[model samples]
Target: MKKTVCAIIIAAFSVCVWLQNAGAEDIKIGSILRLSQGASDGLPARRGVEIAVKEINAKGGIGGRKVEVIFEDSKDTDQAAVAAFQKLVSMDGVKVVIGPMKSSEVLAVAPIAMREKIVVITPNGTSPKISEAGEYVYRGCSRIDKQAEALTQFAKDPMKATGVAILYSNEPYGKGCNDLFTKQFTALGIPVVAVESFMVGDRDFSAQITKLKQSTFDLLFIPGYLQETAPAIAQARKMGIVAESMGVYGDMAPKYIELAGKAAEGHINASEYDEDYATGKNKKFKDAYYSIVKADANEPNNIMFAALTYDAMGLVAEAIAAKGNSPDGIRSYLDSVKDFDGVTGKLSFDANGDVVKQGVYIFKVQDGKYVKVK
Candidate 1:
């Protein structure tokens, strides 16, 4: 009887260990981001995923299976992004991926993602082409056109700019923004007086600024990432161009202020996330974010990129919890559950996998901080 009891106890303990090990099997997700070339944006985005994973794991993970994210550095190139994405799917066996932050990179990897049936959620790829990428691809932020609508409306009513000049980065994102914003501004009865283009790494904007200064425009909109836009604005201002500097969501970082200095003052831009949004969810996210950021001295505490990726990760985790860890399961869950209460706001995905939020928040740089204007 004593031997039989010991045997039974051992058998039960083995079963418990097996069950615990099974529960610990992680549901892996992939993140492909511009970690080296565009680390400013990518780092904040990574932090957002880390925070969401930390929270989800702390709360018993997704359906008792611990969530794990495999990160791959895209280095801000199409080839690098495609390679990273392929590795994530083929080697890491991830059914879902978080990014390839730029539209060009997303466009490059989107075909492969469709072929592999891997669900990809781009947190910041705002190019209008992403709407047609496929059902498997989704975006966390609003479309470029939506941002243009908000920014243009603000230009008409508040800024009262009659003529606008565009200095855009000679790339897909910047060119797309220039085209869309120009159309929106025209619709709002504002004429685009001057247009100039600059390469990605071009630090000297003297030529563009000189030409733009010669033109008569009320507002100068630089449609590019902060890396270029901030410096361009600073150079333009230094060359005595007084057009109120404005930009797209890419300029919504504090780094822009740090780069542009006094030129950033009164600089207007559109943002998908409002840090001051009064909600329990927002407060919780802010607190958790600050706690993590405070610990990591190198982390940029910017809320825009973090908020976008946080919502994306939350959506993925929710889908996994509701359904299994299959791509189709995630896609189906996303389709059915339109309204997700995100830190950004109420997020609803349209048929094209585009998030439908209330509206973009119009912000202006005042005293080296983003102040909400609309």
Candidate 2:
């Protein structure tokens, strides 16, 4: 009889602990950023989420419940990403998770979000395969495949090149971009004249530049992170590969132009957010961003990193408000989100959970600065 009474007491204790945990203080949002180790651009993306969370919490949070944001670094590996994601979802018990920062990380953790019924909103992982990462996986930016189509259109319409050389960073995100570009280039009836590859963080690209210069290609399409891209373009310029160069979001940043100088001049790329292009809806947030970061309001691609993650967090908050405090409820709320205008732009999710993104304006590094090209 004593033992039975003890068992009942332990069960009651466990229930109380669970309830206490659930009713702690505020609604918690999770994020796993590959900030320090992966790509430098990922830092500003994470910062954008931070800035938004602070503002939201300061405004008494969603529905007067304060928001608590949980953060972990992805460390630029599959193992690190998976562990961070598991910690965010299982250990921290988050209702919504923001990111692991890259496509490889998204591929790892998105399955868990689906199984755990948590919404994972990746701000930068743009690989086309995200379309297949179950129902709960959502992203707030353009898909790399769709961007390839837009790029193809840009190549044919605005920046015409008789032939092209393709370069990528040999990651899932980079390879996916390369694949889409290859298909789109073929469909556009243009031959891919050459292809080159380099690992991220390599300082030299002379051999690849030599090959591209010798080839019949009149343009170069590089799909990789900005860290490698800056060096590659600088090296390509030194090696006299004068084709009109372009890259995707992995190469989106003012730092690229700052590093490459004259090499990256006239370079064009597609991005979801351009600070110069935000509607009146983003004025307050934009002002807040400049005040917090002490950055220029006119910087062209500043919106790419911080704004993307900010919108992801904002949408997560909106979903939480729509669903109260349940994971399944939040999932339904996210799916039911029809039109969410964010700091980036309107957030309209297709059935596959990617934002139907197109503020596909091309940008050029004019006067050693990133300037929007209409």
Candidate 3:
């Protein structure tokens, strides 16, 4: 009887040890993204993180520990983003987080992330204000100012745009683009003849287009998410306001072309990733992304968001592997990182935690496809 009781106690101790070891084998990270509102961009961003995690785990993960990501829906609002960040940090105990993709959402959660000392990297936030958000906040994409500079230069030089008109979405991202691009255009000796704004879900752009038509402008620049931008461009073209249309990075998506149809022809925009970029790493990532997107017919196909988030996840993993899995450790690696090759480009971080990548690519829609013009 004594021997049996002793054996039972030893087995229970061993079981408890195994359970603890099993729990410790996984390194938990978190992601807050637009899973419901603005899902066209958000879904692809989520897939990018997932693909990177899968690849990392397949290669034995960071420091031989498996990686697990806890994802939360931001619902494309500031309040939802704050709640998501709180849940991820306080409840899930993740030291690193990879989203809240919009500039508004990123700014919303920046304070909490800084307070908690957690590493937060946004894959697509582009507001100039984000530069001052906090030391713990990082962005994987170029700022709107950078895009405006490159695009306005292209407009002045190649397009020969002497006068410009603006149609912008009345949101943080779109409004920021309008303000920056307007300044850039003015600096380049091109005058902005007219400016118009539309709400997020506004479909009938006839009124704005009519206002723009009254102005004698050689270039029409529309900056916003594709959901509104595409339809606005289609409506503008229908209203006969054809004067060399251009857009910011938000216009780079298959859905944009699909929505604009014939109106998308000759439309120009700045882009982060080039689908035809010749690299083994890019090819593998592109193939994996397409395979997954093709399997789900409902999935929105946009490689830009996915590519950015994939690189963000890759950088985070590299940081954890090089240093430890702490927020400070990750920030240290990012700050000193130079020429970290990503599918998007050779990436580094500036003093402001914004990605210093090879300059944005200029693409134009021709024959129902986006062809890199510069």
Question: Highest lDDT, which number?
Answer: 3
lDDT (10s digit) by residue, model 3, range 1-374: 99999999999999999998876568989999889988888899999999999999999988888899999999978999999899999888899999988888899899998889999999988888899999999999988888888999999989999899999999877887888888889998999999999998889899899888888998899998888999999999898877999998889998999999999999999999998889899999999999999998999899999999999999999999999999999999999999997989999999999999889999999999999999
Worst 10 residues of 3 by lDDT: 19-28
Q: What is the Cα-based lDDT of residue 10 in candidate 2? A: 100
**Global lDDT of each candidate:** 0.90, 0.79, 0.92
TM-score rank order:
3, 1, 2
> All candidates' TM-scores?
0.92, 0.88, 0.95
Candidate 2: Cα lDDT at 204? 83
Candidates 1 and 3, the one with greater lDDT? 3
Query: How well is each residue in 261-361 modelled by candidate 2, as lDDT tens digits?
Result: 88988787877777865577588777776675566443333557788898988888877777787777777877778768787776778899888755566
Question: Model 1: per-residue lDDT, tens digit, 196-308?
Answer: 99999999999888888888998999998888999999998889988888898888888899999998999999999999889888898888888877897787757789888
Model 2: how far residue 17 lies from native, Å: 9.6
Clashing pairs in 3: none
lDDT at 80 for candidate 2? Answer: 89
- Stretches off by above 4 angstroms in model 3 are 1-14, 17-19, 22-24
Which is the better candidate, 2 or 3, if ranked by lDDT?
3
